[model samples]
Target: MSERGRGDRRGGMSRGGRGGAVRGNRGGMGGRGGRGGGGDRRKGREGNNNRQAKKKGGSKVIIEAHRHRGVFIARGKEDMLVTLNMVVGNTVYGEKKVVVEGSSPEEKKEYRQWNPFRSKLAACILRGIRDIYMGPGSKVLYLGAASGTTVSHVSDIVGPTGAVYAVEMAHRPGRELIEVAKIRTNIVPIIEDARYPAKYRMIVPMVDVLFADVAQRAQAQIFSINASNFLKNDGHFVISIKASCIDSTVAPSTVFSKVRDELIENQFKPIEQISLEPYERDHAVVTGVYRPSKKEKAPE
Candidate 1:
């Protein structure tokens, strides 16, 4: 009777163990299926996000050449200057940046950032000065080239055929100008005082334009002297006059009038005078012809 009882107990334990194994298998399969579905859903969301980004802005960059010659407009969800990089992958003074979209071994194209805030010339350009006179292949005699920041942009505009004679008096800034000139072959950096144009007489030839940004009491005199030496007959002159530099106590209008009169007296015919009020207060850019020959002079 004891043996029969023990055999019956063993058979019952075997059946219970088989039932648990079948239930465990079903639970395991359901958990795996749920996990797989969750993973697929996450992947679908990631793909949707990528598609949306592409629709918002098709590409990373889009550059269009500007209407103005030697200028370009860059659009990367924003608008900015399409400038040529003087030093590849390097900035002179924390200016904007634009990458060259298409380039090749035979011909390399590069673009750098032109910031209006940093460069007065750039501001003037944006202000719509009809003829800057410093275009491609133009010979420019630039006075007061501070650190060559503007000079470098001018170099890019003028291209290899053109030349820029940058003159800065101070030693420290002159050193920086030299570095910029080294990179851009067309620039001729002259570390000499602009007040005395005769000092560097041998280096500068008759230029198409004479640009002066000196902040001296006699700003007109400095420009007159330089134009007389280097500007060709009927050549243009763009002078940036700062009223405070001339006389802080005097009214800004008074200062501008005085400068304009002085320029006419020196034989520079004033064509148009524009005030850089919003960009720069108490500052004006005077554009005119330097000593036009009697034949070339227009009728009043």
Candidate 2:
């Protein structure tokens, strides 16, 4: 049996819809996780009221930041909108210092940002994923961390106390991710294909969340293999599926169904699935819980 519900499609709002519309005070994030800063303060429209922080040195560059709801607006050279609950500043090794302090992150709560592009996480937010649980101290397995755009946000979310094992198959991007991780203590970038978690088993700890953005032909299998070894029993697997990546011949729905079946066989219970349109074409971010059988459950 299978259950279906709404999925996270945050940054997707910028798609199909006119990108220019975001240029207004609202500032549409056309899928790039629009990082805005500076200029006159706007009205009391609450941003993301979650925790916020920063990394700096002897007032080298004081990034003026404001909190609104779950949004963090940094007034530096440019106006940047990051989630207060996620991470504080860019993970730049030599200069990565918490300029401002923030509340500790939650271990098992889903958090989103107001990014309109560059990451499926942003799309998932715009789509309204009420079940997302990316918070502090969370051990996340990021499948596709390209150039560390969304990885930075995730690093902020997990905070210094938490850990994020970013897995990227591409060497170039993985190198950049490693560099980024150098600044942030929590993010540990691993240069390996997410398909083979066993090879990197020594590095990846049991994770609270398995976030996969790798759009591949055998993505479901990829998620299954990785989840089997690393996903915690109560953990959640957040996967972004691209229809084209699965099969161009059959319908997108078929691809999703097959993927779900594969995950179910792997002991992952389906939670939610929603199409990531506008932001990402023919794509979806699916959430599932990994609950072992009574026999598989370890002694408490």
Candidate 3:
């Protein structure tokens, strides 16, 4: 992959210089001021609707760049992770989010808040993952991209230069993934089981990173298979493992240890690991490299 397709410098996507800083409406007109003087119920209702539309659905909302590249925290009344909406005014699922257009047609830009509870990758970001190795122009292979909720965010992160090969086993979510891919040219929706990487080898390419959030018991094995096939040598990987999926009877700590060992045995050199606690129960995110050359030792 080209260098531009693999590296997106952190803090590179901030819009502050471009006058896209996070905007807030703390001085919004009070509801009491919304009281219509006539006291007519019909007028009152209309006034209320007009005021509500201005407050919630207004075009004054601000979309600011977050600390992480390609990620945004929006401000109006509450804070939310916003993306440049891939599909204008359309939501893939019933996710809690809003889309706002700029003041003029020349400055039209949309943003969507990312939810941590519904997505493991979002949880990882909220949990303070240093580097997911994803950025503008970085190609990614996403396993278990169900319904394209998180994949949408990944698509935003990669921007238009890169691509995401999203693999889903079920036909139901695959349809939605296709719809998301339709809007975002960077996404390549693959309707196939991730367990067998060879099945979709023709469609996938050597990616900068491989991310897997599968719930299968043999998730580590699945990650290894995909890494060997599409992941570039020494490429990074992030996998979300659900303890209950592997063994409900075992403790989460034990489950994580076993999974880590399995990854090591498969030639993966783990770099960082974090628990997706509070946001997710009995879950963890592991970041690592697929393979590495042996380090040389100095002569004694």
Candidate 4:
């Protein structure tokens, strides 16, 4: 597995600025206080108005449900992928937060901005991948959950009813993942190698989806073993393949094709293959069902 790093702090699409699509007017008050303290009082009133305006500016952005369940699109100056924040007023990985006021107090929802540059899953969604398999209440087994950056968002998507079993072998990132899990109870951080599922087999149960992002030469093999261990019959699997990680000597297309064939050989029916372009180079996301259940024939 390759080391994961926070690539960029920018949380949304690059339309005209880096501070996201939403912006507010920052009114400046400059001048010495008057003899009666009128200037100071006036400046104070103006500052309060500016603060109120700033708060109002954020509300202009609209939240709409995306084609995929549990995923949403924040529409404003530019479109951004977002997920409802499970832990309100708390942030994971320092991503931007959007607060949307609902009709009722209990209806108020907070969404976390998902950056494609920082997360491969975000990139896959932005790239128009058909189906992710896991949604609300869908249990997931995530391999190579480095620092739980993407896992946290997956946690948000799954909400409280669902669970995400995140496995990270590296001690440093595994620690960070544990911290994320502490905040979001839905995530179960497992510090173990993904190659051997037997080690953590007791902790993880049959999951609706198995997602693998271990950028290793034997990633396909790793995915296969885990799928066999935890994935349910007719369950789906999503794997992110790094071309260079497999064979740097060959072209990326060749590597992708070979990996696809390898997955097919392991009984994975490839549904859609999406290229993570602009966000990540020489990388692709392959998703499909594992051992799809055979449909019964109609009466002849």
User: Top model by lDDT, which number?
Assistant: 4
Looking at candidate 1, what is the lDDT of residue 300? 85
lDDT of 2: 0.62
Question: Please, what is the whole-model Cα lDDT of each candidate in the order they appear?
Answer: 0.71, 0.62, 0.75, 0.82
Model 4 lDDT vs. the true structure? 0.82
lDDT string for model 4 (55-91, tens) is 5533246678888888887775566778888998788
* Candidate 4 lDDT score at position 2: 14
Tens digits of per-residue lDDT, candidate 1, 1-300, equal 000001111111111111221111111112223432434555655555644444442224455765556665655444455455545655566454544433464343455657665567766666777767776788999999989988888888778888999999999999999998888899999999998989999999999989888999988998889988999999999988889999999899899999999999999998888877566778888898988878767788
lDDT of 3 by residue, 131-174 (tens): 78888889999999998989998897888888999999999989
Rank order (by TM-score, best first): 4, 3, 1, 2
In candidate 3 the C-alpha lDDT for residue 172 amounts to 97
Which candidate leads in TM-score?
Answer: 4
Cα error of candidate 4 at position 176, Å: 0.6
Any residue pairs clashing in model 3, and if so which? 22-64, 81-113, 82-112, 83-112
Candidates sorted by lDDT, best first = 4, 3, 1, 2
RMSD of 4: 6.9
* Per-residue error (Å), model 4, residue 192: 0.3
What would the TM-score be for candidate 3 when compared with the true structure?
0.78
- TM-score-best of 1 and 3: 3
